[model samples]
Target: MRWDGVHIAATGVWLPGRLSAEEAVAAGAYDADEHAANRIVSVAAAETEADGGPSAPEMAVRAARTALRRAGAAAERVSAVFHSHVWFQGADMWTPASYVADRTAGSGVPAFGLQQSCNAGVSSLELGARHLEVGGAVLLTTADRFSGPSFDRWRCERGLVYGDAGTALVLSSVGGFARLLSTSTAVDNSLEAISRPASPVADPSEARRPLDLSALADDYVRANGDPRRLTLRTAQVADASVRQALADADTRMEDVSRVVLNATGRSRMRWQLELQLGLNEKMSNWEFCSEAGHLGAGDHFAGLDDLVRSGQVLPGDRVLLVGGGTGYSCTSAVVEITESAHRPE
Candidate 1:
């Protein structure tokens, strides 16, 4: 949706140390041939909380603290906290969003959790922008760690590697560093089954099986006919989302200084980015994303943080962020940097 007077005051990202593809192959955690084919350099791996490391919510807390501090946003000024994630957040049937809000914005503001799959980050941003229409600031945070028995970061899905990260963006209706020009979303719900198993698990034993997106995708294609049909439809939807976002922002593809997309591997990146959106690889944050791997909902926020911190995008440069999730939904947003900020040392 097109918006006015909504600005991104600051962004923060907490990324753990890297786990190189070579090390993963040597440890038999990754296949060398697959690594070569996907062309991923490394992925961010988080230390387990059982080993005295921060859990997913703690990571989100860290990122939120940084963003709050950077934006000079006080507790009373924040209207709500919106947290998003993909994997289990340390416990079952607990509210991680409340925890994030308690630690960052105090207990006064209401907390919400969004589950829009990988698109939840940008989607939350879109929602938060609307919340600003009612007045106070909104904090958007996303965190995920792909480390557990239920998921194999390297093998859970084909042409993709999962990474662990926490990201936060503070949006204010008052003023900030960048102006949020517009946001748009498109959905093709028929494609949701592409990530669902043909048969739902009936037993507890069956439910614990590791996620195998490749098998699920195969099942969908086998049942629905050709896979190309899925690809074509996805591309068309994403293209329309992008076109509308740019149009709403009164900006063109050629006018954008950068594009940030999901942190998928090389082949899928080529298809969705260059071939589909017609954005040059250099103009996109593919290099940084390849090294960090797919960071669930943290992809867009972390990428934009990197661009600002690294000085890759200057003031007045417009940035386009495109995100898609397993629900077969796509969200695109346009942001225009209004001024420079002090880069953390």
Candidate 2:
């Protein structure tokens, strides 16, 4: 939907130490062949829970503090907190959104969790933008730690390496460095089986086992037959969303200074950048994504934060943000930098 007065007050990102792909390969944790094919230079790696690293929600709190500090007085107006995630958030059946809200926005503010897979970040942005229409600021946060016993960050998926990071964005109607022009979303629920197991598991324990996305995808292909039709549909909805978002913003692709997309591997990213968007890596935030890896639902916000902090974007520059998730949902947004002083504190 098109937005008028909504703005991105501030953004904050908390990234853990890095682990080079080469190191993972040398340590036998990563397949050398897969590393060569993916070309993901490095990924943010968090320490194990036993090593005292912050949990996913805790990292969100740290990022929220940074954003709240940057927002200054604007933070006081936040009326709700929306936390997004993909993997297990430290505990089952517990509300991570409430934990984040208490640590950041404090109690009494309505808190909600969005589990729309990787698209939740952009979905949260759209939701927050809508909430801003009702007269208050909204806090959007996404965090995920793709580490060990439960998930093998390196081997759990094909074409993507998971990362550990927390990202936050504050939206306000008052003032900010960037103006939110528009956001759009499209979905194709028929593609959901690509990420689902071949059959439902009756045992609760078996159902909660570690994910093998590569296997799941293979099974889906085998059961569904040729995947070319589904791939075409995916590209169609993604491209349509981007086109509609730009149109709603009253801008064109040429007007956008940068594009932020899902942080998948080279091949998948190429499909989005070259085939779907008709743009190359130079026109997008692929450099940041290549190093950080896929940060679950945090890619778009973290990429926007990096662009703003690094001063790669200047005043009046327009940025296009696109996100897609396994549930076969796509969301696109347009943001225009209204100031040149968005550097980190």
Candidate 3:
């Protein structure tokens, strides 16, 4: 799955506005003392191209525009679109995958979307890179709004961390950015219950639909408990995927100058790399999620953007991109830096 001559051409991110963790709790987003309280994480409070709701096609399009501009590609020039599924409490599935295509003006680039919760961003890019190998540019965009009514909305505090944002990466075989090098995927369906959305927005009967976590508390607890079975399985699968991805790229972890782990926060931040991935404690410096918040499916891309913009990355350095989804799907991508672009970093 590795490629020696591949590289990433550009990365762009769009954040609507900040919603402090305290403000979110004051507004009654979640319990004051709950572990997973939706205490403000990063939220896109402005006018998103997608409008921050179910079927957020416009939002996805906006992110795409930024990324394409970064890579100097025009919307009309894009041939394919890959997006991560969006979640808004009480709304679901009304918009089809084709919705993104329509907003991009059906400019001939087909569209596909992933609803794999957290893992959707990486998975979408993996597929988009494959399209790039065919000698064309592929637009890969990820957008999420955890501010919706769903209890799965982001949670945070001084003791916790959260966030929201959208990201766009222009991937192509033409030139620029980091080469995708390789991607690895591992699945443990046994841990499937760890996270999920109970009902689609289409369900007409209110009773047939789950309006809030009040009714599904039991299910949520069983699925995401303190003794998180998903966390353990994720560690195993993610570690395996990282090793394999690096091996595919003919590299090693020590060789990875930059590592982006899903939003590093209080509870999970300190030991996330060591306890979960069996890695050394030094990686805490590059953690991106917590400061960025959970970002729904936008986790990895946003983190990657930060790295590029901060001048934290350098040419010839290998970057590790990793994370997972609700179904326990995890992925690792190895990228080699080639351009500076002055990204701040």
Candidate 4:
């Protein structure tokens, strides 16, 4: 849908220490052949508080403060706070969004957490833009630490390496760095079983052991049909979402200067986005994503922040943010930078 006055006031990101893929291979934590195939060099991994690292919510607070400061927005000025995550956020059934809001944006803001898999960041932007009124501001944050006995960041899922990081975007009706033009989302429920466990259960312990995604995928294919059909449908939906977003923004694919895509493997990136959209590999943030891995719902936010901070995006340039989540949902957003980021703060 088209947006009228919503703009991105500022963005902030916090990435923890990184672990090289080669180091994982050397330590027998990852397979050499798979690493070569994925073409990922390193992934951001979180450290304990004893090592001076922050928890997921703490990182969100840090990033939110930076974004709010850059936007010159006081805690009282924030009307809402939306935090997204994909893993256990150091607590069970606790309100991390409230923690973030109380610590950064104040106590009375309408703060809540969302779980849309990896698409939550972009989805939050879309939702926040719709919620904003004249002169209102919304704080959107995403953070995840993919560690522990339940998940292996390096081997839990195929074709993607999970990362630990926090990202924030202060969006406001008041003008700032970039204008949000349009956003769109699409979903295919048939593919939902791909991420669902093979057997349904009332308790967590009743679920399959190890939570093997590969096994779940195999079961989905066997129960449904060939997996290629699913891939084709997913690519079609993703391409359609991008086209619709651009159309709503009154722009075209050729007008987009940058495309921030999901931090998946090289093959998936090539097939799902670049090749499908006829876009050059250089137009996407693949090189940076290779080093940072997939930061759960924060990939697009972190990627956009990198583009602005590195001077790759300029005033009047158009950018396309696109990604999908395990719910078989795809989303895309079109943004136009309104001011040169090179100007002194």
Best-matching candidate per lDDT: 2
Candidate 4 residues lying further than 4 Å off, grouped into runs, are: 49-52, 74-76, 343-345
Residue 148, candidate 1: C-alpha displacement in angstroms: 2.4
Model 1 alpha-carbon drift over 4 Å, by segment: 74-76, 203-205
- Selected candidate, larger lDDT, 2 vs 4: 2
lDDT of 4 by residue, 168-287 (tens): 999998777999999999888777888886667898767665556777887888988878897788888887888899999999889999999889877767765657888888889898
Worst 10 residues of 3 by lDDT: 150-159
lDDT tens string, model 2, 1-345? Answer: 889999899999999989999999999998888888788999998897899899999989999998988887779999999999999898879999999999999999999999889999998989999888887799999999987766888998888899999999999999889999999999998889888877788875886346778888888888887889778888888888998999999998989899999898887788778887888888888888889999999999999999988988999999999999988999999999998755536
The predicted structure with the larger lDDT, 1 or 2, is: 2
Clashes of each: 1, 0, 31, 0
lDDT of 1: 0.89
lDDT of each: 0.89, 0.90, 0.63, 0.86
By lDDT, highest first, what's the ranking?
2, 1, 4, 3
Cα miss at 261, model 4 (Å)?
0.8
**Model 2 TM-score relative to the real fold:** 0.97
Residues 1-345, candidate 1: write the lDDT tens digits. 789999998888999999998889889988888888788999999988887778899899999888888887433489899999998898878999999999998887799999989989988888999889987799999999898688899998888899999999999987888999999998898888888777777764777358878889888888998888888998888888899999999998899999999888888888777788887678888889889999999999999999988888889999999999988889999999998874654
Error of 3 at 103 (Å): 4.0
lDDT of 3 by residue, 1-345 (tens): 765444466777777656555565678864566435322244444433366443245556666667766776433356777777546522465544456566653645687766776788887767776776666677777765554333344332223344446677777766776778888888888665443345544554444332343334346566567645545666788878888998998887778886766654545655666665556645543344433566667767777777777777877877888877657788889888788766431
Enumerate residue pairs that collide in model 2: none
